[model samples]
Target: MIARFDYIAAVILFSIGLYALVVKPNLIKKLIGLNIIETSVYLFLIASGDVRLGIYTNQWAASNVIDNPQRAVQGLEPMINPIPSALVLTAIVVSVCVTAIALSVVVKLYQHYGTLDAREIASLKG
Candidate 1:
């Protein structure tokens, strides 16, 4: 059986991030934790969809991979699915946008309350 240590590492990273997000009182720390969780998800996706060359042969010889386009669709063990990698790319872009928006919100919150603590901010509101 193949070892799934990568998955374990990703899970660990995700757990750490989750702990930080839940335990940290500072908004910045929560944001950092969110990013860490995102990193872990990326790692998981990449690890799950890992593709090693030469393991799976196409209908044609390995040498023809570059030359014959048809060989790509007709493979022996099947080529690695590109969907996960593509999804990861989209996720990365979305994550960056989310982080940027979140940081901007954090800045505004800090400016309004002069503090970065979530508890303090909440108390200040009411």
Candidate 2:
């Protein structure tokens, strides 16, 4: 439980965001919730990629080869995975673009309907 605190926090954040996205009637609130969900996903990905007490690849190699020659011949050293972090970075950029588009749509909707409430906009349309 203690070791997996990040996972727990991510779950909680996701739940809160999901609640806001589903239960809120305001479009802006929904966008905020969506952002929260994205953030939680980012946190989860980063945490999943983390290596406890692990050294960087270069540092590990240098330390083994230079500081401890015998350790170099033993095997590969523990290092944090880079793939998840890289994927998260890509997701963040995509998320920003998506948020920008969503906000623009929301702005248009507000301008047309004079309100940001989803129900109000629907009623106005009908």
Candidate 3:
């Protein structure tokens, strides 16, 4: 039986991140929530590669992969599909951009209101 601890942990972390995003009124804390969610997303993506899609083939991957099959004879891609990996890389870069922008906005908001709390932000002078 394949232990799905990674899946369970990722789900739990995602829930925490979602809760933090919803319950936190501080802009910085919300950004932290965003980071948590991003981390969960990356974890999920990595996990997908490891999950068995179950359509095994015997085509050869690289020579080394051919040399070291967990099984024998039949060919397979050996390496999980790289599509998710590439997408995850893109997602990471986009998440970084989002974080940078969020931080910039927080700084501006702080300058304007001298506070980082969501409710306090609206209380500041225009």
Candidate 4:
């Protein structure tokens, strides 16, 4: 039951984010909703990469060596795939950049219209 909590939390967060995005009229709230969705995705990805019972292999130098074929087979403990974790790290950086750009755009929009509501801004633009 405890193991399924991460997925449940992800679902809940995703739904909340979706709801906020669909129901909110404020541009800033919509941006926050997008951030929430991104966070939920990151949580799901990190959960997928989790290995509670796996052995930690810290072979940085050995990874470069092509001669040691036996090293790969020597581990009896299941090794967690490192690619997802690495990808998640990259995603985090990208998410931050996206959020910053989004916030900057929102700032510009607010400056131009003097309002944060999406409906109001649209009406003002027309």
- The local distance difference test score of each candidate is 0.84, 0.84, 0.78, 0.79
Pairs clashing in candidate 3?
57-75, 58-74, 58-75, 59-75
- Residue 45 lDDT in candidate 1: 97
Itemize residue pairs with steric clashes in candidate 1: none
- Once all C-alphas are superposed, what RMSD does model 2 give against the true structure? 5.4
Estimated TM-score per prediction? Answer: 0.78, 0.81, 0.76, 0.76
**Candidate 3 per-residue lDDT over residues 1-126, each given as its tens digit:** 246777787898999999999899998998999899999989988888763434343333223444456543354425566788999999999999999998998999888788899977766668
RMSD of 3: 5.3
Q: Any runs in candidate 3 off by more than 4 Å, and if so which?
A: 51-77, 123-125
lDDT of 1 by residue, 61-107 (tens): 34544455576667733356788899999999999999999999999
C-alpha lDDT of residue 110 in model 1: 86
In candidate 4, stretches whose alpha carbon ends up further than 4 angstroms from where it belongs are 54-73
Instruction: Give Cα distance to truth, residue 6, candidate 2, Å.
Output: 0.6
Shift in Å, residue 49, candidate 2: 1.1
Candidate 4 global CA lDDT score: 0.79
lDDT of 2 by residue, 1-126 (tens): 977899999999999999999999999999999999999999999999876542335564444334554553565544457799999999999999999999999998888778999987887753
lDDT by residue for model 4 (48-116), tens: 876644123565422532355465457633445678788888998998999899999999988888899
Worst 10 residues of 1 by lDDT: 58-67
Quick one: best TM-score, which candidate? 2
Candidate 2 Cα deviation (angstroms), residue 77 = 3.4
